[model samples]
Target: MEPENTTQNKPRGRVVMLVDNGVKGDSRVQKAARSAADAGWDVVLFGVSPDGEKHSWKVGSAEVRLIPKPGPLNPRRHDMRRPLFRRPLAYRSPQVARYRVQAVKAWRSDLSFRQAAVKAARAGHPGRSAGGSKARLLVPRVSSKVYSKWVALRARETTDLQQRRSMLDARLDRATTALWQGLMKQRSWRRLTPNLWDFELAFAKHIDKLKPDLIHAHDFKMLGVGARAAVRARAAGRPVKLVWDAHEYVPGLPPRHGRWLPGHVAWEKEHAVFADAVITVSPALAELLKKGHGLSQLPTVVLNAPVLSPGPDEVAGAGPVPDLRELCGVGPNTPLLAYVGGINPVRGVETIVEGLTQLPDVHVAMVSVPPGKPYAATATIRKLVDKLGVGDRVHFLPFVPHWQVAEFVAPADAAVSPLHHLANHELALSNKFFEYSQARLPQIVSDIRTMSEMVRSTGQGEVFRAQDTDDYVRAVKAVLADPERYRAAYDKPGLLEKWTWEAQAEILDGIYSRLLPDRPRIAAQPSGSRADARA
Candidate 1:
């Protein structure tokens, strides 16, 4: 679809979408922003920039304003000597001390066990005492020398290892310090949060300036941000409406290394009550939010589907499209399996690479963007491909724009969504499910509840046991064996239409209309139309 025309008459009211992450590849936020804009609301998307650069740009009728997070908040820019000060005082509270102590004790116990085992092995056989007296005495002296020498060598090795570790630690500290000093010199601290209080304080000030009619928070973290902003706006007599758009089952999200799930769930629950309305991405997630938060009503389910065009030929764009066959240097008849979105661990991307080993003839095209930080799976996947000897069959494509994703998938024989059966993935109905349907390409989805149900009900594709390499291989092979049968499923009347953003957009519009009944609705203008009526 085309970007919304900004030259139309002035929007009736303004909406501010608060998100924690950058807006580059966020399809859900983009869709919501465009839907609101199409329905006559001026949209301002407030998000964090990746490079910590504050900037603003217009995307159709929406204006994206990004805030650069402060260096103190980023671990890469941490001053090792002063890192403790960067954490919020509340995070260093006594309650957190218990977890830290437990972790430290566990690590110490493991290290002690390893050292004890090494010492015991060096000491040697206990049964040697049963030998003859002379043999024992003579052996003990010789053994003592050997043991002493071995122990000395081990001590020297230990000292060397400790010295190396200390040197590495010092180097890391210096690097962190340099980065922190550089960021501080740039004066970007003004945009950053020294602590949670500072972040909320800055966010409130930014929200106050926008004076939005409604604050649409994208996820649980932003719910707090939006609620705080709403309070500030109301105190200033703006009285903005708050809408919590929960993209995942926050409480059920799989635990990560440093994440505090309980605290996040409690925070979301506390602030969710303040929202005028709550909406989620799936029916299952909506139910979970209602019960989890003890809400009086269930959240509206707005599936993450692509915008459907009138026909397959009208998907989007008329420009020169990149050919997957030419890009991969493969023949046209070669079976291509396309996987799109972020190549993250939880997405079961490893299974895809492993499954490709079983199917030598099938070429896998991963159309994805690189994930941030140490969590980047593209490097890992590439290493796996080389190790498994599937480098010739696997191809990695640079990030395709959301609008042009179809172009990449169109040439492929089938699309795959092999999400692991985590609580969040189990309930999620991802955009790829519908994107493949819109392109009339068959899908091979993991046997998660929501996505599996969609695939089964629509008869669009096949489902495989999630995280099972054999099952994924079998599923893809089955589709590739009979591609025509699965492709015809999309040809069914009203199937693709029901899964489009246009359908979800109506539900989103209805929620907004009820929330702001007094707000006038302007007729949508044609693309590139002049604002003659307003002029």
Candidate 2:
């Protein structure tokens, strides 16, 4: 193939991706943004502001604006429903519980409204009882004494019904506000600030200012927001395709810590009906869409891949960041096991911690590169490290910037992910697994589907019984002794191929392509097994 005289940074379509701003330092988002920018999409991001700054939006090569989630009116919102007010009762906080009570009260209003309508019909009025002539005509003629008695009885009942209905109406109004709030939750109040409304104008307004051909919306968070923008553009008679990348079983899940709403499920189906194209990430998720819902018909499943060339220097420059022994205060020959990402129970961080106690010279440096909330639990993990007498070994790097991650984990003897025995964990495809390959660092992973199959297939790492701390410890010792012996397994020719964001964005590129078939088609279907794509 002849090399074309082209600049790598040629612009594509104007794209506006939505993510939490604090995740600016997260490698995944960074890679996604880089891929979109390199492909020539005028990309701008809208995330919660980092500082106390409010309502910020930027435009440029790849603009990143930090908008306050809890806006000027309500800067520190405790309810998640109101993007500006992100408090959720799911924390079971007194305030959240009060909101729950209010929710029940609001639903009761709907019931009351129905009752009011029935009573009104029975009284010979659809909305209210107007005794002008219709009321008198509806009632039968009788003696003055009998008629007076009937009128008195009816008036009392009418007054009681009206009072009850009025109360319910007020309650319903309040409940609607609370329920809507519970639907939009982020880890913190600030994170929810920029997402002020369910349909954010700032997002569409920013995108419109950029004016891209196709709008690719990831997750249901931006489904309606992006679709509405497409509708507005369409009304203006602009031919814009609204692409939805469905990452979850949206209708299958409910609002965070919210009671199931039959209406929410209906709403997702409605949104898909309106979208130009819907893209899904997983086959299972796609299958669920098809089987559980009639969404299999939509052209979906753009495999996560990279379209751009790998930065040779990133891998070439990939070397250990710190002296593992010195950083963790262990002896020169102590075993240093690394685990990246935030520490969470589901990811099996606790199991890793518990297993580490049994190993001699095993210092688990959990490079908490990325942090997410439910702070109380994260705090608890740090305490466990201290209480377990491994305080010196386990350290939480609450915030790890993207570039420096290479430096932190480069020197690790081996990396491990001891996830619990959950179906989700079995199919896990975390960045750590890929990063280990990139750095040539061997791994000791959980014996679940994706990680287990990966370890067994590639021999790049080892796997152990997921919850069995004893097995995890045994595997760690085996890998630390001779990681290179098993290196032949995972370091395949195309192993590093898909982990890059440039590759991953191709999946997005595929979804967007169907949206605008008339546009140029530069994407190609990659040759791989289903396991490879899933991994």
Candidate 3:
């Protein structure tokens, strides 16, 4: 660790922020890093590198470091105690015992042999020589009756044994599952997810070397990373404060197969209590986090609003924002609807494409994530578009800078947010909701609790049944018919201004100030001092 400057002018404490993404398009983390750096703290943001090599760049005053995230990538490999095939009883499927198989086969073989012997005896019988045909027939019939009774008795015994084995397997399975779940309650049980451990292995040493005064963990995965790092730093006699930024309500996220959902929920529950402070994107989320973590104070709310403009605190490098109508090859007279953010089924983007079939001359501009790369959801949406024969009307564009989203979509006739009625969607406002309002584009939002209520209350636009194509078409036409009336919602006092990143940054800065009052301010340093600075 760098020795503290002992001079009369002490350097401000350093802050390290951890995120699980590549950090190229994560507006919330970028905004937080820039805001903290502007407030005079030496901030370094760490993210997972897409490539194997480590890379670094400057996001305004904050230094962004992308650490290589090497992995086996499978959760099952993390458990040192068991091999892949030898999973715990609860995770393994029941197999028929070898003894039972052998026993059943032996009984069937004996019965076949007895039946053949009886037929041979009937064929060789004294047939009409002594007591004639009656004797031969009687002998075969008596043997057949005896053999049938024996087969019935053995079958009943085999059936009873099989039933007992099934009952035992069931009881054992239940017991093992209960035991595994009980073990998961302990913090050490996190080893089940090796990828998470890989994250810690990749970033912990770098974080420790920096000896940061504060660790701001973004989302659930980093919360554990930051919390554990803080514990290590404290043990080494360095005082490190921890801040957990809950990006979403983990329990409310869509269900995932295997251990993903429960593992993350457990991980969050374990580490959230260690945070000196917590911040989330919405008031509803904040309240849930407060109660869920049993924190004494409610988490500070920082909505993921768009940048009003490039201020001293905001980061640059998003490149030029494109104009929506020009990008769509549409004129002002043509009706255009815009959708931004990730492409997913739950996002309800299919509703928009399906709606286009009914509303001719209406074009859609969909801006998806990771810029140019094709993702699974993107492919699905494309297939739907092709199937519906609306390929010509829908224009798929790469995402613009987060701050520039509103400007990018400003020329569209109206913005549509057709998010499905998921729990997280219902409980919070989406980034597009605020972005559309900032552009003064009339909104066509789904009837999710938070967004629908906001749109209805503000009179910004109309709400439709989530994922209902017919209703979505109705809302889109309503807006297209009289966009002026819906656009008037922006005229309401402080509506747009209240939802900008600048407003949210103030609350963020205040939280920082309150948490680290004693920490001194670090003087601004040059960017090229780092060894890994991008060429």
lDDT by residue (tens digit), candidate 2, 1-535: 1111222343345566666445445445445555555445556655556674644322223456555444443322333232122221123233444454455555445445655665777777766432223344333323333544544444444444334433223454346535544564321221322333433544556556555567666666566667667787888878877767665565445243222223344345445656767666554566666665465474465443322333333334444345554666766576778887766666788888887688756777777744455445578787877888877777555434344444457677788877776644554455666666665678888887766786787788788887788888888878877877866655577776765554667766666556666656543322221111111
TM-score of each model, paired residue for residue = 0.71, 0.62, 0.75
Q: lDDT per residue, candidate 1, 236-264, as tens digits?
A: 78768999999988767754312234335
Better of 2 and 3 by lDDT: 3
Task: Give the 10-residue window scoring lowest on summed lDDT in candidate 1.
Answer: 526-535
> What 10-residue stretch in candidate 3 is worst by lDDT?
87-96
- Candidate 2 achieves a global lDDT of 0.56
In terms of lDDT, which candidate is strongest? 3
For candidate 2, report its TM-score.
0.62
Question: At residue 348, what lDDT does model 2 achieve?
Answer: 81
Off by over 4 Å in 3: 1-11, 72-177, 183-188, 311-320, 520-535
lDDT of 3 by residue, 1-535 (tens): 2232211232556889999999987878987887677667778899999988788877767788898888865534322232233222211212223344455556556545555566556788432233324454556556655655555454454455445434323465345434655876735336434467788888899889888888999999999899999999999998789988988898898644344555677778888878999988887888888887789999888898876755433333344667778888888888888888788778889889899889988999988856456777888888999999999899988876566778788889999888888889887787788888888999999999888888888898999999789999999989999999999889988877789877887777677767788864444343323221011
Every candidate's CA RMSD: 15.0, 16.5, 11.7
